[model samples]
Target: MPRAYEEIADERQHGRDTHVRRPRARVVRDSGRHQWEKDRARRPPAVRAATGATERDTGLLPDDLVFSARYRTIEAPGELAEAFGVCEGTALLERSYRTRYAAETAPFSLVTSYLPHALAAANPDLLDVSREPWPGGTHHQLSTVGIEIDRVEERVSARPPTPQETRELELPAGTAVILVRKTSYDTRGRIVDVSDVVLPGDRTELFFTTRLERW
Candidate 1:
C-alpha cells in the first residue's frame, strides 16, 4: 500500500505535464547574412530627417527657425546660482550680460550656448581691436564699431516649458527646452559679455559655418 500511494503521488505530479518545447536561439554562420542584419538594424526607420537634424543642413535658413533673445545684467554670482540653480563657481564675473533665445518654435526652448558680453561693455578702450567673426568668413561688425569679443564660455540645460512659453511658443508634445549660457571676452582676454538663450529643438536650427584655409 505504501508503494501504491507513492506511485499515485508521482502520477498526480506528472498529470499536468504537456509535451512542448521552445526553439533554441541559433547563431548564423553566414557572414553576409550577419552583415545584412546589422546594416538593416543601423538604418533609420523613416526617410525623413529626425528632429534637430536640419540645424546642421545648409538649405535651412535662420528665419525659418523661430527664436528670441532676452538680455539682462548679472549682479552677483551667488544670486545667479540661486536663480538658475547652477553651481556658484559657474558664474564667473561680478557683472555680465545674459541673453536667452529659443532653439525651436513648435517645441520648447533649450539653452544651447552661453558667453560673457559684459566684459567688453565695461571697458570701451578694448572695443576697437578687430576680433575674428564668430564661425569665420563674416566681418567683425561689432568690433569695427568698438566692440570686441575676447573669449566665450557656454553652458547648456534642458527642462519642460512653462505654461505661458508653451502657449506662446506653440510647443508640441514630448518636446524639450534648451538653455545656452554664452560668455565673451575682449582682446585682453577679459570676460566682456554673458548671455543666455533658450531654444526648442523641433522648430529651430543653429547654423555654424567655418572657413578653413588649405593646410
Candidate 2:
C-alpha cells in the first residue's frame, strides 16, 4: 500500500470543512510468460548499463560492470533485523554488489541487497554469485521462488562519505555521498527485499512526481 494514501486529509475553505478521499496507488496483476519476461526485462537500468560497455547510459547509472558479486549467510544486523521484523540474530542472505567503469579508477556505485535466507534458499541459483547480474534483478530472483514484488519504497539521505567510501568511490574533496535505502514489498505486504545504495553525489539526481487526485 502507498504511504501517501494511508492518512486522510481534511480540506477546509470558507469556514467549511470536507473530507477528501485518498485512494492508494493501483496495482495491476501480472500473468503468464510474457509478463514474466517483461518483468525480467525491467532489471534496474544500472544493471543493464553495467552489462555492456557499448550500451549508452540511460542517465540512471554509468556504463560499467559488476566488479564482484558474492553472498554469505549472516545473522541479520541491527538495521536488517529491524527492517525485516525478525529477531535480532535471525539468519539472512547478504548479497554485495559493486560496480565500476572498466576505463575508470573509481567505482560507479555500491549496492548491498538482502533477503530472507529461508525464502531465498528455495532457489539455489539465487545463492550463486556467478548468476549475476541476475536478469530482472531481485524481482526475477524472487519470482523464481513465487515472490511477486508489489511495491518499493526509497528513503534518501546525505552525509560526508566515510573514509572507506571516499577511497572506494575515489571522490574528490568536499564531495558528499547520497545513500538511498530501498525497501520492497510483496503482494502480501511482506518486506521481501531491502537494499542500500551509495552514490557519489556529484553525479546523481533524484526526481519525484507527486500525483494529485482530481476531486
Candidate 3:
C-alpha cells in the first residue's frame, strides 16, 4: 500500500471518516480526456494540438511557455503485467511525465504510460526515451510499425492523494484526486498502451456524453 493510504488506514484504525475534507482548487473540464462519444478518443496529435491551443489561448507562447517530459523503462509489476495479459516478469517501457505552464511552480498533472517491451521493440524509437514528446505522440509512433489503434478504454476512480502525489501535484491538504487508467487497443484487439493519469479532483471536472440512435 502507498504510504499515504497507509496513513489513512492507520487513522481509520482510530475511528475517523476521511470524506469530510473539502477540495481547494479547480481545473477546467477536460472534454478530450473524459469523452467517449462518437468514438472521439484522444490521440497523440490531438494531445499536442490541445496543449498548444491551450497555451495560445491563455496568451502564452514558446517564449513564455514550456513542456517537459521525463521517462524510463522498468519491470512491470504483477498486476500491471496482468493488465497487459502477460506474465509477471515481463519488461515494459514506462514513461513518467510532469507537464506544466512555465510560470506555474506546479505541474498540470502527473502521467505514467506503459507499453509492452515486445510490442515497442518493433520500432526502436518507441524504446528511446529521448524521442519524446514524440512529434505526433504514441499513436503516430505505433503507426511507424504498422499498428493501428482501433479503440480506447478509460476507467476512472477517486482516492486520496498519496504523499508523493500530493507533493508532485502541489495539492493542498484534504484534496482527493481522480485516477484515470486509459488503455489503447489495436485493430487486432491487442492492448498497445496503458496510461495512468492523476488529476487533482479539486481542479478537475469529468463529463461524458451518450447518444442514442433513433428507433
* Deviating ranges (above 4 Å) for candidate 1: 1-145, 204-215
How far is each candidate from the true structure, as Cα RMSD in Å? 22.4, 17.1, 10.5
What value does the lDDT take at residue 168 in candidate 2? 87
Candidate 1 global CA lDDT score: 0.39
Candidate 2 per-residue C-alpha lDDT over 98-190 given as tens digits, one digit per residue, 9 for 90 to 100: 655343445556778899999998999888888876655676678889988887778889999999999987777898988889888889999
- What TM-score would every model get versus the actual structure? 0.37, 0.72, 0.74
For candidate 3, lDDT tens digit of each residue in 1-215?
Answer: 33453555466678776664332223453435322221222344555444442342233454444567776668889889889998887888888876565434466678888988878889887887777656446666677788877788889999999999898888878989899898988899999899998988766667666577999
Question: CA lDDT of 43 in candidate 1?
Answer: 40
Name the regions of candidate 3 deviating beyond 4 angstroms: 1-64
Q: Which residue pairs in model 3 clash with each other?
A: 25-202, 26-203, 27-203
For each candidate, what is the lDDT?
0.39, 0.66, 0.68
Who wins the TM-score comparison?
A: 3
User: Which of 1 and 2 is ahead in TM-score?
Assistant: 2
- Best-performing candidate as measured by lDDT: 3
Better of 2 and 3 by lDDT: 3
